[model samples]
Target chain A: MSQYSEDSGYVVAVDVGGTSMKGGVVTRSGEVVATDRRPTGAEGGPENVVAAIRSFVGDLAARGSSLLGRAPAAVGIAVPGLVDDATATALYAANLGWRDVPATGLVPLDVPVLLGHDVRTGGLAESVLGAGRELTDFLFLPIGTGIAGAMIIKGGPYGGTSGWAGEIGHIPVFPEGERCACGQTGCLETYASAAAVARRYSARAASPATAERVAALTAAGDPVAVKVWDDAVEALSLALATYTLLLDPSAIVLGGGLAEAGPLLSDPLAARLGERLTFRSAPPLRKAALGVSAGMLGAALLGWRAAGVPDARASWALDVPKTSAVP
Target chain B: MSQYSEDSGYVVAVDVGGTSMKGGVVTRSGEVVATDRRPTGAEGGPENVVAAIRSFVGDLAARGSSLLGRAPAAVGIAVPGLVDDATATALYAANLGWRDVPATGLVPLDVPVLLGHDVRTGGLAESVLGAGRELTDFLFLPIGTGIAGAMIIKGGPYGGTSGWAGEIGHIPVFPEGERCACGQTGCLETYASAAAVARRYSARAASPATAERVAALTAAGDPVAVKVWDDAVEALSLALATYTLLLDPSAIVLGGGLAEAGPLLSDPLAARLGERLTFRSAPPLRKAALGVSAGMLGAALLGWRAAGVPDARASWALDVPKTSAVP
Candidate 1:
């Protein structure tokens, strides 16, 4: 049943979100040999989530060993929060109700483990393997459950002081807009994130629906859907225009679930961004190529980097793999 | 008599603003040996302004030769607008009525000549010799005739592609705000810039006053002045909060004419910035130490760098000379 060669090497890449933990055993060239997904059970509290993460890492290592006839060379985990990646500490994750959680120490594996910010890791994957492959300066914004940004400057991710750069979601768009859960008012995410889109539409629509369904309804010319969607687009444009004037990235890569709506999101967002700008031209708006897998793959890239693999060698994974290399 | 020796090297520094051109011959440690000032004559057109800059550079070079017994080693100039620092071209300066002007080529100097964007050069000076000394990450905002920023990341200036980064003035702070000269509505400069503050006050008050006088009137409880000042503070705080969330700088350094008001700007700005931030802490706000001379001093630093001077050696000029090296 094992397909991987004993001579081959691999790393465990995991993305831990509010709802679930997704992981994979990835080869040096970024090929995913196998994957595992499970509920985070955050409602049970921080201890339960930590235990789940530990068990998942163990399960992946065991699975990799069984499939490859050897243990993984390293492990990388991506988690949301104000993470201090250097110390592998999840300083705080509001969604998970945890603080100062040492995520790296949770894993039982003997191999080296690295922890990273989930959004930044996703951005790294996009920067190297997906939409931002050739861009030296760009922003990878994932409009998933919430909106955050991964700033790529001079071909690498820029983590501002304390590794908390790119918290663009918290930036206020409307001076007197609605209050945010973050104790702030009129945050960009409150108006434009996937969660926001669905919550707003559901509040007024005759039939409650997810952001995806709202997009469909909007396309059908439902006045309420159209109005909500347009407001979201406008808010996003204003925030992005602010970002453009400050950083002037070459392009913006939209990722996460909302980005999956394709042209429906990209077209209007791009046009509105253009209208918002004055003298400065808007960079091309692009969709993420790797979809939900960007975070997992980005985690693998971080692992490979931690393992001291050269960027040139790491980038070889971008080419479609011809085989599993398990002979 | 010049204190610099015949053997000692020097650089000519010029800061070209919309209304005036300030130039000086500076010793390596940032001491001004000889100085000259002239009207930019921008109203006479780009060609006239170009002639003034050439004369200023030439005058400083001659003054340095006569004082120090030798010509200066190099020259550095800082000008406004969307400067292509790499090409040393003034791409477009609305105030100067110039487009695609070769600034570096205009200065008929044999030694190496360096040209930089005016605000960025001032930021460089602050980073090395003024308030931001020893700080690794900070933003240098000079709110004078207009508001522009110089971003210092990892101890050096970050000029985005084409050297147009830090154009924070253009960022729309008000959606339905006043129309800006740049063809945009409700830009940050439209409300908070030094020029805007004075102009807005003059439009409302029976007697026209500078931003400094407006600050005094606001302190005296003049309702109109208080209202205008509060609006500017709010708009500036909003922009700064956005910046803080995005970059998380260690500090924010305020420079230029408006900054000269000291506590009037810093106190309200710090308090408002603190109020606007939720999870993130506000970076300490500080006034620029070098005052109006920051641009000229930064230009000298640039020249010294272009002339192969190390930072350690370049800083030696900070020590006031007891006697001219010419002795």
Candidate 2:
């Protein structure tokens, strides 16, 4: 038995990562009709990755058709790249080695399609229904293997003049500190990212350790882990302090792997951020509500937007907190 | 006596600074029919300053009436400190000792009025008819006694979530460096501001030197002057690198007293800014075109905008480059 009728409008939404892609059949009413996850085939080539995405979109649409008795009205995809929204093209994706892929070329059907930057699409989800729901302007930072910010300005993601905005990870925090892999000195990512935390702790401890393990060790009063964790917090506080003074965002929403440490990260970051900012009060720190599903759900909203349903998220009666994880 | 006819419309424009206030009558054809300058009366307090502003606005409008044979269409003012655009209130002025002075209260006429923040208003002039005329997104940085930036986004000045967005001066560039007058450590203003440059040079050279003298000495290969200038350039490079990574602006328009150093300041800053960025090209640094008259011109535009003449700068040609100095 289906909750949606045969005439219910639906769209195909996909979130494409470097390793894998997640595709879903989303109805206009915000129901997830079906979802499928698969490898992006990026190791083969850009052509193979495009083929994988096309196949995934077709498969999801077919599943949606079987459930709703109709083809998808439109498609929306979130990809790791610099997107040219005016031309509906993915300008470049460093990880996937893809460039200038038109939105329509990725879909098998004759439906309209939309494409967005991966992190910014996730920020859209956070802004619409996640942690930044009430914030009109804020920074959405996902601290994982890497760090980048989605600057949600005036209720939407601001990509700047050339869609190269929000590259906060590369901003130099310690002007005289260690050299970054990006060839810059003292980049915030060199000390604060999840991978960085793990690497620094492992190097000091003379043993391999994950960022999670390092966090656990720090909690258990391990000296090396504590030092590494403290450095991360200090670097983040400096970056956040700079961000606050320049942009004056109402709040800063934290996401991705490191945020999962909960109070361990937020407590120290908040204290130092306050100390660094002398004139203005630091913006409140918040936990991301949607977690990993943010990109897919945001793609769904994009799908509905492409289908000409601009108020798609408005009618969504979702219980996001209750269904935190999707299996 | 007047160049224009009786039907020619005009507006009163004022730019209020910490020490002095300038007033002008701007015709619809972009003509400055009359101009006057007076002290802001800050020595007597906020009330006297408000009275001075009110008297200036009335005098300018009366002169405009004599030329155009009608009451002025509207008034526009640029004031220091925080301004609330929505409520048309000068929220606070630290130097002038004023708080929440309404725009209507500053004008003694039955005409519409508008207000703008001083530096942002100057940026608006640069954006409309000056150096940044062709740019839609850029930064207007004035490194005077103090430092601040006017972030022009999407063809207008963006004040951010709380109208405090462009505090680029206060961002901590050197986390463990010297404390600033604002009580922050390693703030960009502490190292890069013209006042800071002069003060630093005087302290090291055992003699007082203006920023201009420091620039000349740096050019003449004085080691102390070179070191102080180098530190300023280094701090600027770090700040600009962070801004570029985060915002991706097209260009940076340099103004204020330090910028008058011209290539002496911009050349080294440009080279260092380029060196700091590892992933992307640095935004080109351009000299501010309007020099000191930017605020008054922007006020005139605001006056036109208040009079419902939105595209006020479309007609009436003026050679900005040739007429660098207003007097």
Model 1 lDDT tens row, B1-327? 555554567888888989998788777665677777889999999999889888888888988878777777888888888777677777888889888878665576788777788888989888887788889889999998889899998778888765778988888787777899888878889899888888888898867899999988888999889888888888899899989998889999998788877888889999999998988789999987777777777787777876777472345544322221111
DockQ of every predicted complex: 0.72, 0.87
Write candidate 2's Cα lDDT for A134-222 as tens digits.
Answer: 88899999999999999998889989989999999999999999999999999999999999999999999999999999999999999
Clashes of 2: 0
- In candidate 1 the C-alpha lDDT for residue A217 amounts to 88
Off by over 4 Å in 1: A1-8, A310-314, A319-327, B5-7, B310-314, B317-327
Each model's lDDT:
0.82, 0.90
Candidate 2 C-alpha lDDT tens digits along B134-205: 899999998899998999988899898878899999998999899999999999999999999999999999
lDDT of 1: 0.82
Query: TM-score for every candidate vs. truth?
Result: 0.93, 0.97
- The ten-residue window of minimal lDDT in model 1 chain B covers B318-327
